[model samples]
Target: MLTQTLPTWLPRLSFAPVNTAPRGDTLVVVFLRGAADVLNMVVPHGEDAYYQLRPSLGIARPDDSKTKKEERTVDLDGFFGLHPNMSPLLEAWQSEQLAIIHACGAPDESRSHFKAMELMERGVDDERGPASGWIGRHLATLNTGNSSPLRAVGMGTRPQRSLSGSVPVSALRSITDFHLGGDLRALQQMRAALETVYAGDILGQETLSIMDTLQKLDVQNYQSPITNYPDTEFGLALKQTAMLIKAEVGLEVSAIDLGGWDTHFAQGSSAGIMPNLMKDLAEGLAAFHADMADHQNQLTTVTMSEFGRRASENGSLGTDHGHGSMMMVSAAMWTAAKSTGSGLGWRKVNSLGQVIWRSQQIIVMCFPRF
Candidate 1:
């Protein structure tokens, strides 16, 4: 029998209405911090202008005999394709669970990373005024009548700005630390003292909710077969995320950010820094996909950066900050596309949803080369 233990707040602790429960669907946001070149990451090989513009940095189309198969984009409906580094996710896209939203942005023109990220996270279209994050709003909308302590969790030391709101969210370094063990009487006493401290103020309410959620995370049982994660900070972070998802604690949202993509220097498209970074990201995400294969239907992962780099490479073999980025939605959303199993080129439709270009539109063709 399945038992759901709803948390009860002590009289001293304050509380707010719990957000709506998940419909069993999960939204994972992969924030690719640092400006990543959307054009290079999502190669527009079929576009002549792409090749013509970045003679040194441009990736070749699928049929380009000079390009190695492993380095080429996996075809997707003959238009936009996945980078060779992202071959792991290709299967997901082929499974029709993945969809790509190109030329879409935060609706803010600010080039500053801080400002752009703020606008995107806050979900404000006009780029003005204080507003909650989209996920926070989504959580608010999802909040059901009764409070479920285990409804939302962010897998880290502190909750991302996107997860902050009136609702209480759990921030965990690991599942092991979320619960208390030992004597029941001692546990109750400790909780009582904590509750006494929390009851009198705004923090009291959040403390109650957070403690309840942690307790829930503590008891959840989960196991995964032997797996290896890279030693990098981002790599470890992703591995932890996989563990939480596998735990099946009713997680509805997970936020992750991977940085060092700001390739203003030595941004090699084919080899060196950029390629290595892409490789790490690809491997991390691939491992995550593999770990959650069984739960694909209930999960959708999305990756995004603030903006793209310049269309051309600089003297230092890197690219500068530019505009118009790309987003990789789970292939699960477009099950039909993944079924076909082919690479694709660029197709340009402006941010406003107008078809500005028909055949493989890369950077120069997609944007005005500003």
Candidate 2:
């Protein structure tokens, strides 16, 4: 068999070394690819305008007779209810770690996915802008002397554009698949060769540091012994992230993108595409939360989409892309007192009120209020 030698610039395990602190603070960014109907996900039942606008697909209020237990939106307070699809997340909200930001969207007016994604990833509103990613810039700011190996990670094969910068960062694929499962001598050779290849490249060096962190975790038997995560892509990805954190790799930030939110056809308000995806999202996130319960303060999860669907349903029994969507931030980092008032308690409202922030700015809400 022909053994393909991985590129010298590509990180293998063992090359870059990082002197990271034990797990401190963690931030998780979830990119819900395609526009999600924010109105449906975080229904403002208090708004008569919302019901009037979305006649067919409007989510029923928790007290409505038409609302089924599973189908009814979880009451955020009394004004808003989570879409039945996102019940799992609602549970987290009840626990005080999950928060929702309503009417949030890219600062730019354009609905173009390419443009929106770029703006979000860059964390900027420049129409003609710099190529560096927003998270990447954040990492650059954190590059203190010791440059920890596992300071940042993106949970996919390709690191999101946000984490692309001059700082060292990594993407975790599979915890098991990432390690070199071979002999000691071969691993040593691979490491020596990699050090030479990444000597000049900054990103390469950072990736090398990530690899070193993974190797150390593998040796520590840090796999989740408590929770049984589902066998799906998102679940596995989250599990891997939890493992990295549990291993005390000093992971500060991570990103994961879940596609299929562009519900053009059977978006399924009662029990369809949106709900199923939300279930997976909720379950996966819940599992991660449970697994890292002890490290709650060290982590935060944020979910966002390019935009929200129209206020009304379309002819296809679904929704079209529209202005303003919802963003959810896990409350893992906030205190109970802070989260209660600061969190967007999914309350019922009487009118389609003006969004609380600048239309051109991205909305970010910390869970648990603190």
* Highest TM-score against the true fold, candidate: 2
Candidate 2, residues 1-370, lDDT tens digits: the string is: 1123522222233433345543546777888888767777777777676677667677887888866776776777767777776666655776777777676776665767777777777777666667888777766766444465557777788788888888767666765456555689998898888889989876567656656656544422334556667678888778777766655556777788888888778777777788778778878887887777888876778888877666666788787766667777775554441122223323222276422212334545333311
Q: Give the Å error, residue 20, model 1.
A: 9.8
TM-score on alpha carbons, each prediction: 0.73, 0.78
Model 1 off-target regions past 4 Å?
A: 1-23, 145-150, 177-231, 331-333, 338-370
Candidate 2 residue 41 Cα shift, in angstroms, is 1.6
Name model 2 segments beyond 4 Å from true.
Answer: 1-18, 143-146, 181-226, 336-370
What are the per-model C-alpha RMSD values against the true structure?
Answer: 8.4, 7.6
Q: For residues 1-370, could you state the per-residue lDDT of candidate 1 as single tens digits? A: 1234322211122224334334436677778888777777767665666666677777767777888977777766665666677666676666666666666565554568888777777766566656777677777865344244445566677777777776667776665667667699998998888778867765445446655544544323322343445566666666656654543344577787787888878777668777887888777777677667776666777787776665556677777766667777663444364322123233333474322212122221110000
Cα TM-score of candidate 1: 0.73
